[model samples]
Target chain A: MNWLAVKLPVLVTLGGIFAVLLIASLTVHLLQRRSPGKSYGELRSRVRSWWVMVGVFSLAMVLNRNISLVFFAFMSFLALKEYFSLIPTRRADRRVLFWAYLAIPLQYYWVAQAWYGMFIIFIPVYAFLFLPMRMVTIGETRDFLKAAGTIHWGLMTLVFSLSHLAFLLVLPGAEDKAAGGPGLVLFLVLLTESNDVAQYVWGKSLGRRKIIPKVSPNKTWAGFLGGVATTTALAVGLAPWLTPMDLEHAAMAGLLIGISGFVGDVVVSALKRDLGVKDSGALIPGHGGVLDRIDSLTYTAPLFFHFIRYLYF
Target chain B: MVRLLRFLFFAVLVRLVVLVVLGLNVRRREWLPKAGPALIAANHNSHLDTLVLMSLLPLEMLPRLRPVAAMDYFLGNRLLAWFALHIIGIIPLSRRPQRGSDPLAGCAEALERGDILLLFPEGSRGEPERLARFKTGIAHLTERFPQVPVTPVFLHGLGKALPKGEGLLVPFFCDVFVGEALHWEGDRAGFMAGLERATARLADEGRFPSWD
Candidate 1:
């Protein structure tokens, strides 16, 4: 193992995360020093939680490839578990759920083995067919359509989509093949997360026109545009160090992450609205749940992975 | 020896596996008394219902919690009977009437001894999403031991986790909503109906919330 090659990107990513957190803390504290409202405390706690998240992620990246794979796999497990907990299923779909849970490990194992063909289609094609087949064999036809749909949606969002992060780590190319996989994963996560924050910040500062008031009242056009602009600039600036892509492709990737991240966030909001819950779970102190934190990645990871694969690989 | 084994098997192993596998998210746990002689009455959905309830309680209460399981089902097999008897310490109540023994007698004795007993007032597992008419057995016990508080617990999604007659267990999320405890007022039918209503209210809470 080339220790310096791995350590360089990992250290740079960690340093970047520290600088962002420090600046965010200072800015939020300054903005709220005069009239500290609920947002002040919330932003403080959110920054605190980000420290833990960044620490753990950096540790995983620095350790080994397998460790990072397992970390992402565990993340998918938590997200899927939260999804299932929120959604209602018919009794007939019980056995089918087992099959759904089983897909997480099998999908990640393919990523570990670098089997791209199986990784891409395992959940969508195979699990989709197998889940309904398992439900049909149970002989409880009542609400069969709803049951199968719920499980398939969960598998798609939680396992199949999230697996793209791990898949990105295994892509074969000149740069990505040279242990640049972790850097790409870090780059994608950093841009997506920063975009989410930029939207929230800009939305609160200058947001007027609601984008979709019914589904998510907090989302606004100002937030969307500001977030896209900021994230696109960051993507281009950090492309050389953190990703295999150049300025133009990195800018494209930025737009994709920004837009899809908003979509994923709103989609999860819609789900919570339908289910009538505030947050998915209370695992994270400020983030509400693992799902709440990673909702944007559900879309960005898969989309960015494919984009990278198509262009570079 | 039995206590240690029960802690190891039921409290530690079974609870961890069940919580992870079923993805159980227990709500309104504050309704469950931290330490008291309360009768926990929940709607039966699957074999996992009891396990889910047990997993949610404080570990200290596990040894004292005696889930009233069906003698014909849990105790029919020797291995299961041993585990239920020794590890889970279930108070087996035979559905079939014996020659002279009263099924409620064991429950009353456990309550008198200050053990928290989990009773499925529905008598047997019913179809998922449907609550069977609760039998008078809970009413009888509550009447006999009026001091014991009957807390209504509604289990949602266990049926989908391990429904009746399913050999394999499914990994689904199950929510346990704990409601307020009811003290008997010397009315059997009214008390039973009130318990059922309380459980149904919790079911609604689990299915949908008043606010998003």
Candidate 2:
């Protein structure tokens, strides 16, 4: 069997996850032993959920291409569901939502078929026109602008942005093909997730000036810069092994992911604030919801996918 | 055997559709009685409301939990009647009464036998987010069975998920707010008003405050 082709990266990623989990387990154990409060309880649960998330992700990647694509597609579906659940919509926009959901499989089908043109324009162009046209037929114009805008924005962020991760798996060429497309996905996920962790650690230790207290109270400039610096260094080190990028481009990708990751987090925060919700939903045990966990990726995935495509592909 | 079949179908198959397809999150489950005879009343917004409420009950309660569906609407066809009678175990209440037949008789018998009954006091599906005037049947039932507890349930987002006359089932996050069981000993008018007020409170709880 040619399973070794996929096995190496899976093993390496699993090893890295084990090391991180061990360190986190020790850290939480020690910190909570002294403090023992709500934050400690949340941290412990978050770490525990990470193990399950990592297991699901690894199994998808190891199984084959189809399973991995389906996994990410399902994630996009969930994130979109959460987004719609929280957002206000007019009674007229009901049918528009059906079309919006219909776009998920069509978009992912393009990814599966490796039809780049359709995948890129399906939501932005076709769905952009189609959703409004469909809403117009429903004959409710009271909240036309707001309703249409809300549906389009949801499709853009939840479906279009997240689909890029699945699209990454099908990028053509020898290097990515040899490395297995999952490596690129794993690379992006690892860096984005690490950036989140780094920011949290940095913010707790050194955060002073709030970046945007109105939007997200906890985010600070110190955490943002510290996370960017650390993530860039890791990206540069891991680029040769995982991605096809040179050191310079990898560093650039890291910087892009780190900054945009924060943007994604706060943007979702702004949405939640506007809607007056603490978390999107209680889907994930400690992470709040699927949207909370993948908020960073909503921005990073599309940007990084296009960046690599522009430079390397 | 039939009860077990109904339990498996609704608890497993129907619950899967409500949870996975509809993405409903039942809140304040503690408000629902774990067992016994209580009239579970909710505001009707869509056909999906009955299914969503049915999915929230404990599996063991399914055999005894009878959702009071309209005989004309759900039993319009033989196939639907069979599914409603056999699978859902509905106590089909006739909207328009025929001579010599009591619509409330069946419901009363079920409650008297210690079976939990789910009723939609709104009579039929109304517009999303707005409550229709509740019918007086609930007050009559509560008066007859004064010992039975009437729990008000407010369903949020089912109207949008599968509103009236919409064929497509759009997946949205729906919340089932099960409120405390209300008991009343007064005139039918007063009792009906109290039930309506209770449902309105649950509805307010379901809605996001204007500032929010």
Candidate 3:
């Protein structure tokens, strides 16, 4: 509570986000009142979901630290579960999945304790080795390699990658000197998600050239470049208030998130394409699933965490 | 009272497990019958299927909702039988009724009273996440009351969450797809065929990733 009360910038940033969402809500409502057709239904759901998502996320960010950690861990669990559901898994390794899920809480536990040594290598090193051994105990070696690879890959993508966000909350300088850990997290997440939207809007309106048509047909060079520019400018604008970085460094961080956010989005598109599904699951109304919503965070969380750690921390 | 216990079991315990432990992604909920004289025939993968389906209906229907379970399996002892029959409100069907006794008499009576019967046509839990051959019991029950609408439901992921023999209940997200209801068109064979098709169609609608 003291952390939130002490930081004016953190409160201001959260308030600004709600204000922007309020405007978006107003815009969507006005359009719907004017048209009142089926076209606005999807827009209405999307806007409504945005309200809930932002509300939940901001509340978690400002609450107790343990609750915040648990929130992120639950998101990781959803992403991991979605990945498990999407991929074709060998039945022999059904029990092996328990270990995969067990890694989530343990990994987050390390983050909570700020034990970087264990957090850095727990999934990639320990779980990576333990999963195969656990599978071999079942004595089915036909598709052992594939099963092992898929499970570990999901853990890395969903659990290990996303845990970095929670870890960012406990960084050395995260407590007092600047906008605080929540600010850094909010900066990364806000920029990454906005970058995703910026790219989609840019590509939808003025996308003429597809960057990688095979992987993601919706993505275009215009969207990619435009998203990067917008995100970069936002990073520059937000850094001084929400982060410890100056304008130049914020722009650099923005460029990283903008480009990496697109990469992460298309990377998941490649996954869904290979698996031959439209979206991941039907958890959220307009959004496909937890995995669909956090795909960019999977990439940006780790990238931005390491970027800040390497530069300032 | 027994009714209070049953209400607490479903309204509190079962709802907690389903909503908290196993997040449900229920589809076509509007297709679910809001009233009685209906049958919800879901594919049996895990024991949780009965509880999950029962929780989907309105809590007020707890008095009228009954799950058709095996007599020998659910009622091996007096204490267990009491809990299953009263708390769970299960209409136990003796798989082997001695000397020409009408085993399905309880089910028919329950249906006659306009109770919503939760039945697993597959008879028992089979291989996890795999559809087993449905026994003729569903057809027999439906034939007795042709007007009772049987809603075919397909449940996914619960088998892996807690399967037939597995005691460990891992948290896995489950999906429930409710399909259009069917009625007895002709004989037991035709009605059975329709039930099979309805269930299989709902299963395909699940669109699970092809299991390796």
The 10 consecutive residues of candidate 3 chain A with the worst lDDT sum are A1-10
CAPRI-style class, candidate 1: acceptable
RMSD of each: 3.9, 3.0, 1.7
TM-score of 3: 0.96
Candidate 2 chain A, poorest ten consecutive residues by summed lDDT: A173-182
Off by over 4 Å in 2: A1-5, A22-39, A174-178, B1-8, B98-102, B184-194, B207-212
Model 2 clash pairs? Answer: none
Per-residue lDDT of candidate 1, residues A164-229 (tens digit): 998877777634343388878888899989999999989999999999999999899999999999
Scored by TM against the true chain B, the candidates give 0.92, 0.92, 0.95
- Among these predicted structures, which one has the highest TM-score? 3
| Global lDDT of model 1 | 0.82
Candidates' TM-scores?
0.86, 0.90, 0.96
1 or 2, greater by DockQ = 2
* DockQ winner, 2 or 3: 3
Q: What lDDT score goes with residue B147 in model 1?
A: 83
| Candidate 2 chain B worst ten-residue window by lDDT | B203-212
Best-first order by TM-score: 3, 2, 1
Using lDDT as the measure, name the better of candidate 1 and candidate 3: 3
Residue A205's C-alpha lDDT in candidate 3? Answer: 93
**lDDT of each model, Cα atoms only?**
0.82, 0.85, 0.88
Error in Å for residue A187 of model 1: 1.4
